[model samples]
Target: MPTLLTVDIGGTNCRFARFSIEKGALTLAGTARRQTADIPDTQALMDACAEALIAPGEADALVIGMAGPIAGQRRARLTNAPLELDLSDAETRYGVGACLLVNDFLAEACACLTPIGAGAFPVLGPRDAATGDGTIGIIGAGTGLGTASLVRDSRGAWLPLPAEGGHAAFPFTGKEEADFQAFAASALGLSYLRGDDVLTGRGLCLLHAFLTGERREAAEVAAQGLSRETETLRWYARFYGRACRDWALSTLCTGGLFITGGIARRNPLVMRCASFRESFYDSPQRSLLERLPVRRYADEASGLWGSAWLAARLIGALPA
Candidate 1:
């Protein structure tokens, strides 16, 4: 059994965990999280990664899920962080022979493949309701809207499908949606809503403002909850729900809607209040969207777990 170092680099936080394969079971050694902006360069990030790995090994390799698109086998265009890193640079700095770099959202979806109990993860329907297929859809709202699809092969192992679904233009369906888009176009110079624009935490604030004319940060509105109700927060909930519903329908997520990311977790008030089901089932033909199971991952560390799993798969220790 060999130990692997797994890293998940987000715009806000970078988390690393060590896992070792012991008699066919992957065991967690330890995990650590550090801020991304605090590190100046790739070298500093590698140093942080080195410190995060706990077990004693010769440092076989590293697998990282970065926040931006990865070009070829190396190089990443990070969305939030200023630094763009090459995989070869990371391998040289960490003294590892190989490295795997994947988009952050895809990594999160891979992480969710592990069988987490119903208690650890909130379920929207029966466990048997997941369609018994290897297919899964993931949605995350952080600095941006993140999405990825997962397909399990005959071996029941998860494989991440690369997608730029977030960059897709948002489709406006209702009168309110048209009105909201008009406001955004005049205010933000956006011709049309992007999936990232309305699905993110800041997007919530944007929705709140469009609905109420009062502009406030997403954090403040979430912190205030319904204590200080304004027309804005109410609209924010509705818009957010509708956006989620649309995404679910577009993805046809039979496995489940695994909602991770900072914004989705913190804005419980909005999720509960929003007409999520109504908007979700509002499709013209509703056989799929009406029955889609939506669930939220309360634990934010699932990405790191997925990164570890990715490392094992890349190393040939675990089946893909």
Candidate 2:
């Protein structure tokens, strides 16, 4: 059996896990988490985490799922974070045979292709039994909006496709949405506000201020749990559902739509709101979307799990 090191790095925190592969099965051995701010740079963070989590040279390979766009093949940089990853540096620093870096949402999408446990729950349309055969779509809202898809290759293996769909222009549904867009444009000092401008954690704060003329942190607004914030939450859900539907339609993700990230996972009520489903099954695309299964990626460790799976495949412990 070979052991692999898996890392899921986000804006606020980073999660590390060790997985042991035996007989084509991956098992979680140990896990640790640390705050991202506690480290100075990517190398320092990885070094500290690796030292704390695993015995030197114990890991056969390493896979890192990081927030933001991944640049370069052998060397990658996270768009929103101040870290750069070079595979050669990582292999030497971590004492691993090989290392791979990928977009965090791509890892989440990979998780969707695996067998989900009880952590996942239905938040929208009925669960479809045939979800295993087709494409899967994923969108998450946290520090930013993340989007990705999983499509089966000719060999019937699911491959993750990562994209920067979050930067796409925010769609406007009506006059109210247009008005809100105007407000976002002026407030953010931009001619165009992308999906991240209105679908992320900071976006929620912007929404609260725009609707109530009272600025409040996203966490504070969520904690208030007041009726005044219901409309804002609904708006968020609506936009979220709209984005999911668009992705579903674009990718023909009949397998399902999985919503992950801090906002959706921490605040499940927003996803359960009627507005969310309404926007998801909105008229024109209702026929297509209604048949697709939808589930929230409730497990916080999904990215880590996904990374482990990728590592197992890379090591030939699992069929590709």
lDDT of each: 0.69, 0.78
Backbone clash count for every predicted candidate, in the order shown: 1, 0
What is the lDDT, from 0 to 100, of the residue 123 in candidate 2?
71
Q: What does each candidate score in C-alpha RMSD? A: 2.9, 2.1
TM-score of each: 0.87, 0.93
Off by over 4 Å in 2: 115-118, 128-130, 225-229
lDDT of 2 at 310: 84
Cα-lDDT of candidate 2: 0.78
- Candidate 1, 1-320: lDDT as tens digits: 67778778887788887878887666778889998887666667777876766421354557778888889857786776697777666544556765788888877887665543132344343444543473677777787778887877677766687676677787676787788888776676777778777666666666767766678987776676433455655666555566666666666677776777887676655455545445555668567655666677777777777777777778888777
